[model samples]
Target: MTLHEITYTIKDIQGKGKGLFAARDIKRGECILSEAPLVYVTSNLQEALKSIFVLSKKNAKYFYALCNVHHDISFEFGIMKTNSFPLGQGSTDAAIFRVSSRINHSCDPNVHQSWNPKTKKGHVHASKNIKKGDEILKNYIPILQIQEDRKRLLQENFKFDCRCSACTKPSSERDLIITKVNICTGLVKESAESDPATAIQYVREVLGLLDKIGGICKTSYYYDGYQISAMCSDYSLAQEWANLLLESYQIDE
Candidate 1:
């Protein structure tokens, strides 16, 4: 959606500085906003610095207005580190978007953000139903991390302590579930070849654990299901998982 057509608006949140809030009630899987990056950066500091210097006057203003928590670092690098999102998983390249960068963090976020390579734009979709005027939160770190790791990473990288629902509540139960997910995930990979049936069972366990934690991003797990089913020559189950993988991957598209 264009800036004017966006479903969320930037607003000041108490204690959280600036944040994005739903302009109207949004349904699950609905696209909230999509925009091309205002600045692109690589891993190299000097190259990224050059990219910021070359921004248009208006774009430069927008970039400068973004929050930079890394005050101890170079001004340009600090903004890049704080605001940019990786182009994709394991990608060394990242992009800084004007609107998406404004979304604040939550351990249990109501929205999911994805980079659409085909459209060359970043898209944010409602992971669950969001009410009008509610803050549109997104997970800044891996969703499966325990509370302690989540807090440590946020403090070290973003220079803030999170008080989101996930952080404020008791974490023992949550941590246990996440630990189970990691173990099941490892088992899924290990048994996928030699024991396809067992691998499928582990995949379901992982998905169940993720569901218990309100995670809707299960594309990778579905892909593993598909791969193992196909390995065992179960075309029916493989097709089912393939469809699930496709639907999950296209949620933001």
Candidate 2:
């Protein structure tokens, strides 16, 4: 389907520094409008590919061909390069299309992306009730990071310095976010090697952080729950958290 035909609407997002797709109506999970190529190369000859920006003639031709077949190719490719999440072992050679990308990056985001390789798609769902005009956002990196690191990564990759809530907050508040993130990270790490009692303590601490930050750190809570459940060898609990994560973010199983 064409971009214009899709259920979502493309609209200008403030502070995001780009136009983004927003839902015009409620949409369910696993709804596929388009599947973007993970990597497009013009030349099968690897030597011909030099920079990431320059699509080789062969790849460009392929993209053009796809554009002919798919009306949304240009929009797909534009969003793919701009917001697609990297996949594979390394080098970000592969990417997945996601609504979370449209939401832009925030140190504290209200939505998150969960990739399902089985379906070759990434699902974007709300971490909270997002008002009609609220700019949907996802953390480009782990939510638990110092503002400096978050700013640095977003600037380097997205090419725009973030002006999200956490980024624009006073230095004291930013440090609080960082400190909470650190506490969560430390708890998760220590839980990996410690006794169950210690691990549970860490889990509680992480959950405390989650309560403090609200929806912005939903992904962190989801991950922590999954890890703790797995450590206890409780697949059911793990599955529960996994489902919670998927449901909260509209992730595809």
Candidate 3:
């Protein structure tokens, strides 16, 4: 789909100091857009150079087409670097586009993007009830870190400190949530190296911490948020945690 055809409109995010998409209306699980890359470049330096050389000749028509089609070359290149989605089995080449790259990150984002290699397109979807004027967001980095880490990354990459729910929370409550997140991270690490018997102990510890923090600890980005739910075969809990994650985000089972 062309940029203007998409249902969302770009708007200035409060405190984020960047443009973000906002739903024009309450969109269901509808496909907002499916976009193909104007340019596909590999991550490996040598491979990328080689692909560029090859495309310069083999796909020269398309290459010239992109150069003419896109107005801001530098911005397009930056977006490709920042938001290019991976494609090809065992291949490092990434697909870059305009609309998807405009999406800013959030710890609690309302939209998600999915890449489909067969179709050669990335699908953007609403993950929650995005209000008409709510700035549509997708977490750029994995939101599994504590508040400090999350804030640091946002400031460094996006040039603004996050005002997301977790970042703007009261100091006392934020600290407690961080403590629980730390505990859960430790338990997950321990579980990774422990025997089945010891794994259960770690899992129980994580669940206990989750219970203690209540809603504050229940945000989707926590590292071990779905571990207990997955461990106990609690599909309901697992689904809840899955829904919390941004659409394109993945967790090992």
Candidate 4:
């Protein structure tokens, strides 16, 4: 059986410290990395610290090798704070991986990261065609947040200022798009129960806005459209939305 060759490598990035980079040209939607965590724990400080104690000597060495940007905290906790990724949406727990944690942040990122419950691993996929040697970045915060809010959150949590393409450019245009998406998202929620058709319309609006900025999270919106249509007894449109939702999901898979 042929094995898949690794497509990424860890490299030292100027100003950004260490970063994940493409080792070869990678197509959009390609799975770049799928890795199980070295440590997984609830976000509670004591629980997380205790979890680290059970790490084997080799694994403990690997964990400590990862970066710790928060100098004020104890070394172990600071490393956890800096490198852990949330297990899933709304998850109270997180996982720490060796190479995946080396990925740096960009507001306009080229990769998407998700937790796979079935496989119990974290997956990273290329969201855009990445040239060999290009750094693979992922958005560390919600993509829809405006520039000021993103900056504030990044600085407060991650202790760094992002100068990514999205942040370095004039943010007025992107901020306007973000505002439109937020407005449409609110309308979708508000209208879903009383006006299913209108909710679908707002979902489409959200999808379009996302497409304008690389279609970061369209699966959820497509599912929203499908659910609302089905609830309203619009079988035809519901099926269309369902197919779209599946296709969007499979791309990430």
Worst 10-residue lDDT window, candidate 1:
1-10
What candidate 3 gets wrong by more than 4 Å, as runs, is 1-6, 11-20, 27-29, 45-79, 85-93, 185-253
Winner by lDDT between candidate 4 and candidate 1: 1
Candidate of highest TM-score: 1
Residue 226 in candidate 2, Cα distance off native in Å: 5.4
lDDT of 4 by residue, 25-86 (tens): 99987888888998886857787788789889998998988988899989998998888799
Candidate 2, 1-253: lDDT as tens digits: 6642443554654544343444544233433234444343222324212333476676554433321112334544443445445543243344533233344566766555555557665555555555444555666676567778777776665667777777787756657755866776676676665665476566667666666666345554677777777878978878987887777555322
lDDT at 233 for candidate 3?
A: 74
Candidate number of the best lDDT = 1
lDDT of 2 at 70: 25
Task: Sort the predicted structures by lDDT, highest score first.
Answer: 1, 4, 3, 2
Point out where model 4 deviates above 4 Å. Answer: 1-5, 251-253
Worst 10 residues of 2 by lDDT: 63-72
| Superposition-based RMSD of candidate 2 using all C-alpha atoms, in angstroms | 7.2
CA lDDT of each candidate? Answer: 0.88, 0.54, 0.56, 0.86
Q: Give me the displacement of residue 5 in model 4, in angstroms.
A: 4.6
Pick the winner on lDDT between candidates 1 and 2. Answer: 1
